[model samples]
Target: MNIVNEIISSLKKIQESNEITVPSIKNKLTFSQIHCIAAIEYIEDANITKLSQELGMTTGAITKMCKKLLNEGYVWKYQKEGNNKEMYYNLTELGLGVCKIHKKVHEKSYNKKKAIISQYNNEEKVTILRFLNDMNSIIEDTFSEVVENYTGSDD
Candidate 1:
């Protein structure tokens, strides 16, 4: 139980440490912007609708975010050879640089977690995995409930 509490505190710190500064981006990238950049990098032919679906945001919301990303040189939007009406977005060189930095940070963090898990035996690892999955499910349910109940005001 004590170890579990300690782990929870440490994980909170780890989560906070995810913010990394990219010298070129100039503007501080929010969590959403980082994810949006990563998604564009991962998906070829990423259009507004596709990104909106992937990010669970409306196309209008995505368009607004992408506008900022484009103005900041983090992304580029263009149409395909025959597609004038639809536009696709991709990471620019600077965006790719930031993504690489972000990826390395994530990989290092996960690698540390994996190393810690390796200390446990197979049975313990299985138990830990199951516990994590169950906790994640509970968190998802709780988050949905919170969103549903939110009034967005103190009064």
Candidate 2:
């Protein structure tokens, strides 16, 4: 178990944990779609620009996802009074249901991780956090080019 291998293993577990199935959804949602719906619910006055920022996606990509969500009855588009140019998005009942299920899954994951981390002393926790933050910066810098050119087709 080298550090790289350990980090890769942890990422795999995180991915597996995040894979969710919503019973109420007639059409199976992709991970991106599920997160987009959740983001809509989480972000106040959700719009393509805001969603793009929140999801680390391009506005163009967010627009496409929004259209699909709208067609599937998961979300709806609207405009604030006196402002028709900047469209906003919100969850329909169906989207809300999916978001709720997504939230429960996240809560369960959070609690499990919290319990594990709680065993660590404050100094150990700080050290772990600092290490993770550094690793995040390094990974981001290393992958910046790949991420910038990504088409997001895998999602």
Candidate 3:
């Protein structure tokens, strides 16, 4: 197959496998919501501005998601001392519970894949890893070039 076809086939396989493994996690959480949760987990404590920057979303979009999460009782909001405008958000007990569940689901999926791949001989595994690494490097370079061009950057 040609390179473009090979790339498309690889992406389709990865996406299909992800869907099969993860199932309906996306039904309970939008992509942006998951990203926001991950950012919050990373920062532990963050305000709306920080979340927007970290998630590459607008403040308005983050605010909307935060409102939904708050209304769902997955997150709690509080104002910092002497700064009502500077509100902070963190996962509530329920949110943490959901996070733990998601973590386990991810861990199980990863472990299953790892076990299967571990059955391969050492040299074969190394070859597979190297190919995957090269694919990742190519994708990253292409993405970087696209982003730079879109942003009118010179590099």
Candidate 4:
């Protein structure tokens, strides 16, 4: 198989893996909501704008998601002393617990992926990263082209 095809196949396999979930969030939160919790816990004085930017999502979506999170007791909104316009959220005790579970899962995933990279020598590692970067650039260019040339499709 071509190297690019092999890499794409590997990525498809990764996406199909069943071990990509957090038990703490099982049936309680969507993966995006759980990820939002993780981002909120990481960013100091977390606000919708900051969380949305960090997670590559829209503030509108974050606002809606946060509503569920707030209602479900995962987070609570508060003001910074005198500034009510600037809303921030802090994780509730339950939110913190879930965040911890998410963190542990993230660490395990990171370590496993790191172990895979560790098998390669330094030169091979640099070449691998460069190739991936090039692939990403190509995809980005292709996406831009698709958007720029978009027209109504007929099926």
Each model's lDDT: 0.86, 0.89, 0.77, 0.84
* lDDT, residue 30, candidate 4: 65
Candidates' RMSD to native = 3.5, 4.8, 4.7, 4.1
All candidates' TM-scores?
0.75, 0.71, 0.65, 0.70
Which lDDT tens digits does candidate 1 get at residues 1-155? 69989888976776576455677667788777888899999988998888999999889989998999999999998988876899899899998998898898789989998899989999998998898798679878988888777855444
lDDT of 4 by residue, 1-155 (tens): 99879989996676456344445554456678888888888899999999989988889999998989998888999999888689998999878988888888789989998999999999999998998798679878988788677753431
Pick the TM-score winner.
1
RMSD of 1: 3.5
Off by over 4 Å in 3: 1-8, 15-32, 38-43, 48-73, 92-94, 153-155
lDDT of 3 at 128: 82
Of the candidates numbered 1 and 2, which has the greater TM-score value?
1
Runs of candidate 1 exceeding 4 Å displacement: 1-8, 14-18, 151-155
Q: For residue 120, what is the lDDT in candidate 2?
A: 100
Q: Order candidates by lDDT, high to low.
A: 2, 1, 4, 3
Prediction 1 TM-score vs. true: 0.75
- Model 1 residue 69 distance off true place after TM-score fit, in angstroms: 1.1
How many residue pairs clash in each candidate at the backbone level?
A: 0, 0, 0, 0
On lDDT, the candidate that comes out on top is 2
